[model samples]
Target: MIGGGAAAGTIVASADPSLPDRSAAELLVDLQNAKVDGLSGTIVQSADLGLPKIAGLTADSGGADLVNLVAGSNTARVWYAGEDKARLALMGTLGETDVIRNGDDVWFWQSKAKTATHLTLPADAEGKKPAALPTGVPSTPQDAAEQALDAIDPTTEVSTTGAAKVAGRDAYELVLSPRASESLIGQVRLAIDAEKKIPLRVDVYGKNAVNPAIRVAFQQISFDTPDAQQFTFNPPPGTKVNESTAGKLEAELDKEHKAAESSKPAPAGAEQPTVIGEGWASVVTAKLPKASGDEAKQLDGVIDMLPKVSGSWGSGHLFSGSLFSVLVTDDGRVFAGAVAPETLYKAAAK
Candidate 1:
């Protein structure tokens, strides 16, 4: 269950008597205009995606664990000075891993592997950074909620859940619920700092579930600017560094995308991931590349663990958990979503 709204609820850092009474539309406007010049904090992320307890399925990077929709929790320290300077240090069982971005330089360091990868971006005369980089590390809940708030529509029922404490400060809770019944997502609650107008905590609940399945929040936070030296990084001796440029990175990603597309058994003129519906109940269907030889046998072993189901469309293995389900067909197609198995089956049949 979501314990509380980050440390905001626990710490009494601010003197606000209570959350400011505001209408849903007013809160939306405040969130849209939210801005932070500098900040530092400790963030905790927890996930109970209802993944199968598959033995030996461990993540390699601390960054990967932070965003992987699997079972577990992790903590990290974050310092953000601005778009040009930021640092994240993730603490894990293996060891601490750091991701530092200073000006045009980006570094990813894994202490356990004694390896670091560096990247340099080309200077932009306009002085505008790219919108985003596909780093595989998904944004934290606060970031995701901010992005989602900008896309309010009929598919989502938006409202306010009143005031609450977070990070020792009073906060207003903004709630968004999916209107579609097929959606596995029940609702999302964002704890917004009453004064700063920034989200300090985010909680996502499953359909009909009393508790959240995923939560990310700050345990402690401060609005003060972080030290400049935190953004600097020097690779330790004996560390393997694979350096690359922005252009090279883009080329590599393009090549990989094309190769993956070629491998999938997609129908002529059809997209790899085709959405059958929209909103919460939407199911994404993809044609997967068929495995052969030992790989096929291994895949079969995995299928055996899942519940077998069949329909007029095809036969497939169904994997269901708390908040997500996946249908892997014998014909090399996969359907997955946060919706129910019946919803997934309906998509597969179509």
Candidate 2:
């Protein structure tokens, strides 16, 4: 769900689009049972995380299109036909980046860099591992909706936002709000198609915010199966191609994990991530890799940009954003969550 093309403005839902009455519980069930075999659409994703601008840090800089996803807007065209065939083209001002998966063959292409990466999946791996796409860039509303739905539990309060419209289709809006006051997330609103029961838009709001801090939605869509040719990829002349198999990548990851484990001391969970809380207020704490020389200097410079804070848990630089907070401690540990700074401080103390 991660490849897309160009940047597009946000799509506003139609006002007061009337539909048959539906309860929150019924919609939840519909979302849970929803299924789509084939579809193609243009997706618009935007984020306004309220992060301070830093020099030389932009989405388009050095082909860092993923970075732009957190602070700006982007547009992508996506085509999906069942689980084995899918394509996403991320359009940009300079060029386009695309990820295509067809059966056992997967391709990643960057037009500006004239480079392509190809991976041949094992027959059994075909539909098992998701295509590697930029993290946090929901290629479709369904992707975002699935993530939001995962947070549903006793810690969440679910309700209906009534009728709405997305991508010119009538939809029902469902809202999920965190019960914990410390949770920075205000609510996650999902617009599900009335006829199809599939999500067409997702909006995430910060605590007490009127507008969404992040939005991912389809601007145009079709339920018909996309052309089979959409998933085919052939690199142009002079393009640098690197190839590997899924089995080789898995072996490399296993080797790295074993090496790391062997190099660590015998203490259990020393290098493992620890969950500090449950549900929306959950904080994840992990040990940062020890840096030296230029890496250490660069890390220090970046940390210096954040505000300094101290408590019984010690001192660190705290980055407070619209929907999340991150505390990078001087002791080479990082704690982060969709929680308040105080919640992070509490987690650090443990």
Candidate 3:
């Protein structure tokens, strides 16, 4: 996983050649040869984005595709054809473009906000493909599927549960567990189309407050061919685009982050709290809970300043610092968990 959204899910590679009625290599050629009039799929996702980047710690809901790849759409396009740009999430909420490039550079460009930040891409960037593009298009099902699939370790365990229908399509039920990483999904049961050879639904599990409490399920799919026009966008005039390289903005954000952290009071009887004049995102992660005595007390008070949260069910707890999350139960008990605690703090703090 990359960003804070990174996690390990059990990866299951089908040994059965998904050929309609040909050799496996021919199947690859046929699958590649087949043309999708339009590709549309519904997405219900629960992510643990981690914070100080703050917004990363909240649960998010939305759907998009090539049809609405610009302006009002929560869509992004990357050159998955190769490593060009690994993935792009172009929601303008933060007034910036979130670009994950080649799994090594993460740059954010916000015009009106005049803020640009960069992060090092995850180690997995090397073998990855882009997640989206200017127009809604598929580099290949193999590429797209692998992008999601590679996130899971193939060596993890798997089991078949039963059968079900997804988006009105018949599907096989199965559960998967990551043998090593329990980050993204604790366990997942997928609804797959044994015929079309595509996933009908993806259920992700986690316990972090910002992530889904039990699991997130996506239904309502329309792989109906999408119009070709959905893949690109026209940038409006007068929109200034600010961008940061892999590490440019961190220095500035870190400065402010450190300053606010220093202003906090220290533990009782201790010298004043350590004052970091100019702080960055790292400072928020450092000053969070786990402080002793006065430090912890001050941190708790600071946490109380956050907006109170709850689900339709009564459950939520914003941990000290910028940990975004809510309770998971209809009765409200389980915490959704942190999406991106340190990232969230810095974002909310701003």
Pick by lDDT: which candidate is best? 2
**Candidate 1: tens digits of C-alpha lDDT, residues 114-184:** 98878887786124332342333334545767665654556777777668787787788878777788878
- Give per-model TM-scores: 0.83, 0.84, 0.37
Relative to the true structure, candidate 2 reaches a TM of: 0.84
Residue 113 in model 2: lDDT: 90
Candidate 1 clash figure, as a count = 9
lDDT of 1: 0.73
For 1-350, candidate 2 gives per-residue lDDT tens digits of 11122121132323253566677777777887887889999998998888766544432455345666877788889998988998888877568888888988989898889999898987787565346565634467877887887767778877776577788888988888888899999999999999899999999999999999999999999999998988889899989998987777679889999998777556434588889888889999998866567977887887888889999999988887899999999887899999999999988888
Backbone clashes in model 2, listed as residue pairs: 4-76, 4-89, 4-90, 4-91, 5-76, 5-89, 5-90, 5-91, 6-91
Query: What's the lDDT for residue 48 in model 2?
Result: 87
Per-residue lDDT for 222 in model 3?
57
Q: Write the per-residue lDDT of candidate 3 for residues 1-350, one digit (tens) a residue.
A: 21232233233323334312222222222333433333354333333323222221221323233222211223233222224333344443434343444346544444445544445544655644432333332232234333434444443444545456665766554444444331333545555555555554555455323332222233354555444333333334664545443334557778889998897755344432232211111122222223567866664454444456543334334543222332222221223322333233332333
Candidate 1: residue pairs that collide: 7-167, 7-168, 8-166, 8-167, 8-168, 9-165, 9-166, 9-167, 11-168
- Model 2 alpha-carbon miss at residue 149, Å: 1.3
Mark the regions of model 1 whose C-alpha exceeds 4 Å error after superposition: 1-17, 56-69, 125-138, 255-271, 311-314
